[model samples]
Target chain A: MRLLFTVILAASLSLSGCAGTQQKTLYDKLGGEAGVDKIVTHLVQNIGRDQQVFHYFAEANVKRFKKHLAWHLCDISDGPCDYTGDSMKQIHDGMQINERDFNHLVDLLIDAMYKADVSHRVQNQLLARLVPLRQDIIYR
Target chain B: MWKKLCILLPLLAPLSIEAADGKLIATPGVSQIEGAAGGGLVPWAQLAGYASRDEIAVNAFASRGSVDDYSLDVFGAQLNLYDRLELSIAEQEFKVDALNLNIRQRVLGSKLRLYGDIVYSRWPQLSVGLQYKQLDDALVANLLGAEDDSGTDYYIAASKLHLGAIGGLNWLWNVTGRYTEANQIGLLGFGADGEGYEWMLEASTAVLFGRHLAVGVEYRQKPDNLGPKEQDWKSAFVAWMPNKYVNLTAGYIDLGEIAGSDDQDGLYFSIMGTF
Candidate 1:
């Protein structure tokens, strides 16, 4: 009985140490910029075809928008992307936008990300980073 | 005295039992998203994040107010994940009478609370989300041949509960920031002439006055999309919840615009049901 108890204690200790070592940081799980770039590309492509929102971007340079969007996502996620686009406030000034419009845009982006097979955890992380912009985007 | 002790004993005993059991027995507040034991009529600036004590909920809404004269319909779904995060998707259909346009759009987003309680508990909650929108090309082409309406928006929000010293009334306050890049409507034309990005800031608060009743107010400031300008709005509302499955909300909204042509006020109503 004494020998058995000693063996059990040693096994539990080893298991706990292994568990600690297996923990992974969010940055590692996200696959870094490469993963974010793929997700951004998917999102831009999806938006470009969406008629409901496309009217707003009819004149937008898609290539430029894509590059800026990718960099913005990286910067927001605490990664390394420098964004040179206009400030959000400077860009959206004018046409009377509302909460309904904003919500519609959110739905499409989520669908695009889903189609890209972005992991739910990474999606949640990205969403959390984006929530603060409600004030800046929903004018009326 | 014996009768009084009997009455008191029953109440006091339960309190002690609850304490021993480690079950919080305070009056329940609204659940994070799906109408728990609290009120539902008030609008929370913070997305539900992922507090899923309840199950999934789906809601459909339609409204016509004094300001726009257009009929709007909204459909939405909310899900709680891992009892800590809330994900929601919503779509809006706008029928513009003046513009002779019918536009439909969809937004899919998720919110996760980094910390805090959505209901009954007293921790601060933080959330983030992203949205994409697309316009129907036929509608855009019909309304404005050269115009497109598609883009992405992102947001982050934080909320805290304040239990006032007077009568311990429950109060919730939240702040959110949003970044948007999309096209706006032109007065004389459509398309690239009215496109830009915007940064918005908003704040809201609600106070609980009775069981399943709350009143609140919200304010938001955003950029003008037509020209070099900006605009703001304010709203006041009341919420009522009779149970944990249904919610009713009504409010008044006001918007400020340039040249006074877009200034308007209207009433809004919404119903939410959770399974």
Candidate 2:
């Protein structure tokens, strides 16, 4: 009984240590809505510079797209925001998006994150959240 | 060596970093010891190639490592499909001038990436690889007490990239478990009179410097099937990429006493390119 009790105490202590002294949400680390807005704004700008992907956004409503993207990022980061934009499939369907375009967008997004001074941890976290959605965004 | 260098230089000339979107970048982790994908000396969980999830790519490499009494030269080619599977072949010659021993080996390898992405996924990427190693000299195998001149090595590896793990830099960690009897990676043949296949471990960790450079160390456990005291191997290496097409790597290696010789410390140089 005493050994089991000691093991439980050790496990709890390790778990607490892994939880960190202070847990900051990824949303907070990314600096909230204002930060998300800055990243999305720069992301769209970089996308415009990429010739391979630029054509897809050539006729897009920049202001609305930026707003929806910011909210979507916020939603993914566990922030207090709702991504009420069109479904990813609905927006990307019939775009004939290829692997090159998807990777190029990721590169652009990374550039935008850098421009906004987003931490590397936050950048990877965001990329991980978005990478799985490739199934819906590409090859359709 | 010069002839191979001439062939590689021309292929690397036309590729600028930004021009190759559909190509594989010269990431150091893609170069393995047996001329497969992984670290300089140990195979990582990632498959070899610059191919993305939907592309096909081919890569080839030539490398030289020299010690006081020996020099090893390797030339190899690999094909990566959709960044998921890899097939490779290598021919290696170990020339021990002092002992008047020239050993040659032919290695055929294949790797399958089971799941996860090294960079994009939250979980570590895992792969299983098989290598069929055949030695050309039967006299050396018999004299050295080797049970066979040909054997297969099977390994499972897991690699993870931890972004911002070290002072805002990316860190890569890999662990591999191998079942093999090949002595000194089959340069000395397989098995012994007293022993059969043995299990070993290879672990590697690297910290990325920017996007084009990685500095790391690797530790490889070797089976003690040889008569002499052949200890584990360790090395510190740096891999640099000037562009998407070219990769250069150098390492200071300590391969513990082999064939009754004292600790063999050496320098390793490798140049590789993908098309």
Candidate 3:
């Protein structure tokens, strides 16, 4: 009986120990750039069709937005891409964007993330990085 | 047999004690940021994107003064995952009474945080993501115009925990941005035809009174999106945590004013649980 108990304890400790060492990289978990590209593409498409906010991009270049978005996501996730677009504050400086407009964009992005099958953990990880921009995005 | 049972009881007692204390062990894979109740300076949940232990936390709150009227509520949840990365879903309902308008808004949202600890020997914690806010459109529409704003919002947040053991003060500063374009539903009304992008800046600080309690305050400034007019507000609150999974908070909030409307002040309460 004592031997059996000791064996169970040893096994449980070993199993828990193994669980602690599994390291996951964001790039690998997100399936690399291809996965990132899909998410960005879906997000851009949704933004393009949003009648309420689409006008902001009506005169702008869609291709540029797409490229910048991809780069931004890559750089954000600690990927190899470099973001050369305007600083968030500089780009949106004069636009009087509000909470509602901001939230709308968030919804579209969330939908895109869901459709792309981004894991919840990855999504939250990504969000923590983005939450700070509220200062630069909302002009007031 | 009786003597054998007695001998076993001592060993079994330790096992039972551990079983009860097991409840105290933080659930695997989830992380909880140490702070008082209320969303982060950036309007995201306070756990820094991690869920509560056992995928659950319960919070209760009350407040008076500063923002005007008082309010209270409870929040509970289990953090699905809380380790190097975190994902959690929480539900919060606010009973707000001020400006002659008494109403409640039930908000449901999910959050994800990537990377485990923002603070390291060399780097700060950073994350980016979006939140979908589906306001009871019909309910809000009847009460506050055609609720065209029940949509998702995006944000990118960067946080750094300041080393303050020397001063016994804990502080973190975060900046967030939301991309906004005209014609979409917003917190106010439909985006104006010529509306532009909006931004928000938030700063927060906390003072630990003991191992289990802390008081925190935050300030946020945002654009009104009504052309050149800028709107902003400040909030101050206290947070208490009995363990790793639950947090309770209460505070005063001022929502500024609109179209000559008096500034809206009110109390805020929040509860958070992690799995």
Candidate 4:
């Protein structure tokens, strides 16, 4: 148990040290526009291949989704971009996306971030910005 | 019991391996001592495995807790159906060194999700569960003036997970209200000669670091119905999930007093496998 304690202590210390180096904005840390675009592309590709959530995207316009989602990510991450797309509730109002699919999308996003070589710290920052939008997008 | 688990686990594994692994890793909590998906000692609202609504899940766990005057070992299995209902069975062995007695008990448990989701829903997830316990040997309980050798515990639990809520890490919490008549979680028996049931509140809080590790604390209120002054159970735990299939937990436990023994505190360890 003491070993476990030390491990957690060490991990937390390293994480805090990482935090101490957070002078860069989340957008800058996400590799700015290019990295965000890469992550969004991977997320869309993952969703296209996802068996559980693909049906929800089947009737949708892939090009439009990719653009708007990228814009949304950038807008939320304090990037110098503004999303002119519809509100989250407006776009997902009748989709009736449940918790399962929502979380599946989040999982895909995490994978996307990983593929883009985003650090866990930066990934969490992006997720923190996106999670609040869940209320507007689920079970509408 | 270990031999039995060795056989039963392999048999159970194949069935769940074919089931859909819909939920994400580390979302489903570890099995509690009573076989419910939860923290070390308190049952949370989450089910036992990573099954989503369209899948079924099976899990097995073993736990041991040793204190100043006694030790407890538990072996349990759980079946989760469609991410909504949970069924579980657990066997407990309580060894009292002071009395040189080995007491055994069996627990059968079921839980049904009542509302929401732990992560994505607007509100926290909620569930109701029941644990029916029977003492294998009634000698110690009867001698302690317990009313019955068997009893049932009913509880309602609410659980929530907040993404990046604390220091950019996930935070989880569970609150449970249980109405039970058992003493020493049914090893010492149920109720008193005149008493019936009491409501006990239990709580657990945890923070997820990265995706694999969780650190938490739990408190479980106890009912005192016998000569021994029963105290609440408290613990600080760390759970590591290397993947969806396995979780290992270690903790320091404070069990207070038991059967006239005071300051009963020690260590706990558990391992759970989900298929």
Worst 10 residues of 1 chain A by lDDT: A1-10
DockQ of each: 0.01, 0.16, 0.01, 0.33
lDDT string for model 2 (A1-140, tens) is 23433553465455446536547777887888888888998998898777778999999999889888888888988899878789899999999887756876887887899999996656766766776687789778
- Clash number by candidate, in order: 74, 1, 81, 0
For model 4, the superposed segments whose C-alpha errors exceed 4 Å read A1-29, A45-64, A86-102, A132-140
Residue A5 displacement (Å), model 3: 58
Query: What DockQ does candidate 3 score?
Result: 0.01
Q: Per-residue alpha-carbon lDDT of model 3 for B122-198, expressed as tens digits?
A: 34444555544443333433333332454455555555544222122233444545543211123343344444556
Give residue B89's error in model 1 in angstroms: 2.3
Please give fnat for model 2. 0.17
lDDT of 3 at B4: 38
* Weakest ten-residue segment in model 2 chain A by summed lDDT: A1-10
- Total clashes for model 2: 1
CA deviation > 4 Å runs, candidate 3: A1-140, B1-41, B44-80, B84-110, B138-147, B165-170, B180-190, B226-230, B258-260
- Residue-level lDDT of model 2, residues B42-140, one tens digit each, is 988887755677776677888888876778888887778787889998888898888787899999999999997776566898899999999998677
Q: Comparing chain B with the reference, what is the TM-score for each candidate?
A: 0.69, 0.92, 0.62, 0.97
Please estimate how well model 1 matches the true structure, expressed as its whole-model Cα lDDT: 0.50
